[model samples]
Target: MRDLYQRLRITPEAEAAEIAAAIERCQHTALKADAATVLQAEWRRAEYDALHDTLSDIGRLRARLGLTHAPYWRAGPADDFSLPPGPPGSRFEEWMQRLNRAARAHNRWRRLRLGWWLATLWLATLAGGVALGHFVLP
Candidate 1:
């Protein structure tokens, strides 16, 4: 059995060259091992374990905060999740702004819809009253 870092063939604080080499090594090793099996390896170092647990804690924190996805998990062509390149909280604030704007727009639309229904009912009642008065009186 191999630790998580061992399964991934990466070391803590690995240099770029080491990371590249380790990635290649892991790909080769991954061929013979199932992902589940590889990930089941016991921790070889306490520090790696702590780092993994910290990531897990962040996942829990995101869930507790009602976030659907973690902002730091960039899955782009040029992925850089190790450390965020942009200013901290900028991406989160952007996402929050987007959500708030959408919510505000939806609320406006909902109010408009409710207003339309109320106006239609009022017009229908007024027309009914006028028709009744015309039929009943001179």
Candidate 2:
């Protein structure tokens, strides 16, 4: 996703007036109109910010996982090309193995963290229900 704030040359936290000023100063009339339309509304700006943040997070995750190449759909079949045979103890192979191991470890940690949060949320909901039953039912 395009970074609207960067395009407009304004910070994400910029006020409406600041955004309007930046939009007016934009050289491209189409971009200026688009920015004004999106940024002029409170709710649209909030939605754009959320979408931008999520896309940025995904980008960071991809970089961390060494997935800087085009996505799977853009990349051709896996069997299209094969790696050249290397020595038994090649440094590249060793580095790749280590990277795979680290990626697996990171994935496991993320799953564990997500599970913990889900469990906590479930418990909180259960406790709230019990409290409501105890106090409001009687």
TM-score of each: 0.42, 0.49
Off by over 4 Å in 2: 69-95, 98-138
Residue by residue across 63-92, what tens digits does model 1's lDDT show? 444444355544531221133333445556
Residue-level lDDT tens digits of model 2 in 33-98 = 888878999899989888877776665554444444444633333212222344456565577899
Choose the strongest candidate by TM-score: 2
Query: Residue 65 deviation, candidate 2, in Å?
Result: 2.5
TM-score for model 1? 0.42
Ten-residue region with minimum lDDT total, candidate 1? 76-85
Candidate 2 CA-lDDT value: 0.74
Scored against the true structure, residue 130 in model 2 reaches a CA lDDT of: 100
Q: Can you tell me which runs of candidate 1 are displaced by over 4 Å?
A: 1-3, 6-86
